[model samples]
Target: MLRATSRLPAGPSGSRGHSRPGRRLRRAVVVTAVWSALVVVAAPGSADADPGLRLSNAAHLAPGVRYETFSVTASHGTAHGHLLTVDLDDARMKIELLRPGTSGAVTGIRAPVSRLADARGAVAAVNGDFFDITEVEHPGVRPTGSTVGPAVADGRPLKAAVPDGQRYGPALVPGATDEDVLGIGADGAARLDRLRLRGAVVTPSGTWELAGFNQYALPVDGIGAYTSAWGPASRARASCGTNDVRAAACGTDPYEVTVHHGRVTSASATLGEGVVPRGSVVLVGREAGARALRRLRIGDPVHVRHRLRATGSVPLAFAIGGYPVLRGGVPLDGLDETAAATRTAAGFSGQGRRLYLLALDSGAEHDDGLTLGELARLLRALGADGAVDLDGGGSSTLVTRPPGAAYSTVRNHPSGVPERPVPNGIGVISSA
Candidate 1:
């Protein structure tokens, strides 16, 4: 019932009903352009596009664990660098501190990255914390900060809490991430938090509040405790030895409380140099800290509380140092403009589901490394919801165990001739 339209044959001229060859080509071009425009308009936003991360090598070391190596050339300067990222799943891997040298010995010494990972059965690891470059007479180096701050390792308090502030920075400021705290719960959940040490000593006259703990040479004015675990070399200026020792002559005024199994055995004005009783907690203080001790009886119980609003979920925690670079997907406002060198940093995304361990290589002469701002931007580009700068420079090192291998190996070059000894390290405990 349908009839086709008729076209006249060309007789030394173009056909009346048919389109000319040049005309046909023009129509086709217009149709193609319209189709292309529609496709572009229908596409997703730039944010939904590929993040542009190109990996040279990527593999799974364990279930939910990914190791990737990538190189990036900056859009700005001739800056380019190599990066190694350890992507860990919170369900399968957990974060922990790896102290330098043997466990429970002097802690601030240099150990190979490979050795720390192997000792802890960590699949991957990175150096942690800024520490005293000043050499100690004993086996280890001192941490740069006065107090070790708040730390929990293997479900035990490693160092008691101190007030939340940089020893050299503002006082009692708690929210700064560069000097903030990090903690992990038993369920492998991780978070950034603020912490401070609070305690009180009870006496017949009144209760004297204690301010800090393990505050060895930190210039902050507060009374605190120093245990035998702090070692014999007192970094405290008022204390006896700086490099070596002689027992106190017994006229000193700092109060020493010797607590044996939760009962106060001895309280003295004389804090003599000696090994702290194996099962004792020694509360040491100066001035007001000593004043409170004068009123306490030998049998009085001492209570020290790390005042945190009972985060029942997080039973384990530790303090690591870094300036907060990114928070809530935005770079923090006022980062320093220091010259870029090798850099090491850590971040987490997807509300703590994925942990990113990053290390950038130091560049050659005339090559400017990433500044703090640049590093922050890089983390954002890599999809970090939160990020912090870790101990870098000569201290920047990353180590990983090859699949099926018994030992781990250092994968990045350290800027130091011999890698610097650090106070602590952060590692991934993949194996029990």
Candidate 2:
């Protein structure tokens, strides 16, 4: 019995039916007070941060499980690094994982709270749900919300139940609720990822490896996962309302691998009109990850990797391609020096396409633990066709765009707190 005292997040003021569970826990209010578990309030205002993060800057995060506000900073404003993870420092918060009696405790100061903890209590404690994920470069603040429940706004509920549908893959966009399995791909091979997606494309567009992928749901999709109407690769090949069954192999998405000796040619993203650098990629087509199946989506988990090279075009820009192309296109600049060794990054490849799936060292967070620089190297070395980083540290979210989870979508994991529902998810839908 760790008797810790921390300020509480006042529940909904005088609302009806304040269930027993909703009475005790904090409701994720933006309370900037000191919340501790084994201690008292330490540094206040650390929890509340401007959503739009300042690049290369440092943000002193919350009072950890104890007396510590972990420091997180960017590197010279340049998105570069290999290791990526959320720092808990010693957070102190009550965990409500299998506690049936604690359901209505914190009736959502902002939104209702969900649990995946290992403790049971009536007090307010603090701790973190740190996760290993990919941190790519985008424009501004990290994307939020992808919880699981009733509608909230741009956020998702931390809990909701899908009717358990068919087969599928990550390729849905939702606010904070509806766990959306964003069907974004990499430029290369075996690229793990951690990110929150926009509700634009069932398989939205971007580049780079989705670094850390630790969130798993029931059976994302039975066979539909591979042939689901709007799966990962389906949208890539499904030109318009038609599944490029020929190009996509099976039919749905979640990329499938038909063995022509257990291997086929990987796809490529040619340079379009732009000042793409010799190694700086500029465009990544839809069918980038369409054909490569052997090493990708089979029955278990798969990692899609990609890169941004300025080597493709004259002015240097980003283009999508695999390892075979990676080794042949750009020279090694990071760790591996041998040209042929660079080919080692290309785990699998053939004619027009190449695939690379190098095993990254998985540690406490099951992550390569890379910084931006390391990430870039991994992308190139691994043969990423195109890749983009997602929200990392603590904000990497994955959600569905809603028709609801009856469709089966899974987002990020170990979320700090669940989110309310929202509208307009940054989705990756296909006209096909």
Candidate 3:
């Protein structure tokens, strides 16, 4: 058995802080876990593993942050992973989205995880949501490089989920939707929740429902709202495909209406590109929705209101795209047990007081990666009560700044030679 320990600082009264609410405070507390090796027998659709799982090189990055690496012997071959354990109860610890630019931009360009961590001054991070990486179906259209699901940062909604059929990652586990997300709530606890887009565009003619917010694809015949958070990506991709068929031909009738300061400023038949100014919204529509937007004339009054309605009582402070893989300490049924591949995942335990970020290594060296089933099992064994799978494969990456390190460095062997540039990642910030 292997034991890893994390030390908690004392509270204002000089007593050790409690890990959860309603718990008694102690003079000191040592958080320890036993990660023993387990051997699994090969099954039809299960990962076979040797008794080699173990955590090593564990280090406390800050008062409430810890980092470690581990290796496992699997059916295909050997695999390795990097892990970050964060205690949300610590006042100096924070989790935020690590996007490309430092100007609060949510999406547009992709960058290496290390660069993103440095830009955000994060102590540790892992790759985030699946995104639109290619645009082969729509010739001449640039991929928007936007995440597949909703994004909320600093308690503000940045984007909403794309259509389930338009998602770019593997098939979601049973009962999971594109709206599923892993986020930290306003109460300072991490949990898995779903965020639905609640929005409307009211015009003199009629009020139209808004189905998307800064997403790469919109449902067929749907209208989407885009703002400055979308950066400079062209809105054309939003109208290029059908909701059920991602590769369908571009819509013949596409319309765009620009609303600034609550009034229509411009309208166009072809989608345009440029940074949307603050207090401005660009509405893109196709087919039936397009016809409705075309009726709006310049200088007409327009009212746009949108919010990401959380399914839970607690409001989310930070959230990113992902699908649930584990719940209530049990791996979800129907998870892919075979077909191992490098992956990224996040989980929470201790009633959301603790969050775990994990990224698997990929390449010729650590070739055998964890299947979705194995990934869930691994997280459960690591003490995760709930977990969500983030983007993986070439996009899988983990970066960290060890003690005395001048800058954060990529820890895992990313499948790509030069780490794959990604839309965003979950960053661990340590104020201490």
Candidate 4:
């Protein structure tokens, strides 16, 4: 719900006024009028106040879905771009967070947006989040985000939220950065929120802290398992094996883990194949984490406290970690003043009833991209109540599949040599 804050006048018995019925009524009327005006001013400002960007190539791809290309000329530079707007009017349709390969396979690295969308049968999609793109020898060392941030798809956490004291980038709160977040509820309503994730292994003996989920862990360190809900569903590959026990390798220290349902089922030094079995969880890592699991026996009470929490409940959430360019129709501070490059962004309507996706392609040499402030103004002009930056430059991409189309198509030009594979993506799903 939208709320407005305003200061009310002093009580009826003010120093300058008497506490009479007529005077009190007049004062109340004035106060009410002033409060209402303040709210209106706080609401989304006028569209005419936007930048010089002009919209063209506007077309409706499906009910509640539309795409439009735009361009703008500014003192800093010129920009050419496109945006996909989605109105949550269709009750049967939904939005999802797209990772590489199958929904829960824990192996394969990065793929194109087209492939991720087609593999997931999405109606529309875009590159999502910043990731660790450096190449590594380990198969698990694929290009996953340095911090995938908090993501929940279909009520399951594909990636864990940001832990305490580890927050990076600009945000309104310590955990909730300026990196704008998009959350879709089961009711098909879209909400914008700032959130973080925390996890631990809870057992009858005691609770042990977790660093993260589905990522690399240090030797003699602590790490959790990957359920079928997490795509790329494979166990961390241990370097050595003694009997059936996974032995540590990769120049890192060695650790072992035991996975089971409500108790110890199987222990391994290396990750296992296929999805985590139903009604089961895996414990992998070393040191205190390993010690904690070793103490548990069959039928011992164990639970994985891995879930995403928000100010409100949302079955789905994905992150785009760019500084907030706009808030409540006003431009934010710290937008780059000099450098201008191709950009990507996401935003919400004034009432939070609509969502917007934007990607600015590299145009003429002089027509670079939009400054953060300029981008915010453009979104405000386009009716965005709040907006945040997405991975831009070469990583910025926009893709969509028409309602009857069999596959998704890239709608904008990528600045990367060809097209760079991203760690994860945000996609639209047709529940119909």
RMSD of each: 23.9, 25.3, 12.2, 14.9
lDDT tens digits, residues 108-172, model 3?
Answer: 78899999898888999999999999999889989888999999999999999987777888887
Ordered by lDDT, highest first, the candidates read: 3, 4, 1, 2
lDDT per residue for candidate 1 within 1-432, as digits (tens), equals 001122211122111100111111010112112111111112456422332344456656654455666544332333333343433333445677776545432232456666777888888888765443442332333333322344556765555433222222212212452235555555454555544445554444455555544544321213455554554434333222211121212113456677776667887666544445466767665544454455567787665443433234565554454556777777666664445556777776645545667776543542445666667766666656677776677777777776788987666663444555555677877542
Cα error of candidate 4 at position 342, Å: 2.2
Q: Candidates' lDDT values, in order? A: 0.50, 0.20, 0.81, 0.55
Ranking by TM-score: 3, 4, 1, 2
- Candidate 1 overall lDDT versus native: 0.50
**What 10-residue stretch in candidate 2 is worst by lDDT?**
222-231
- Candidate 1's displacement at residue 412, Å, is 2.0
| Clash tally, candidates in order | 1, 133, 0, 21
Give lDDT tens digits, candidate 2, residues 43-105. 456422321211122221122111111112212112222111111111231112211122311
- Give candidate 1 misplaced runs (Cα > 4 Å): 1-54, 73-91, 101-110, 135-149, 160-179, 203-205, 215-221, 227-255, 262-275, 294-301, 307-319, 363-367, 414-416
Error of 3 at 64 (Å): 1.4
Q: Supply candidate 3's per-residue lDDT for 208.
A: 75
For model 2, what is the alpha-carbon lDDT of residue 62?
21
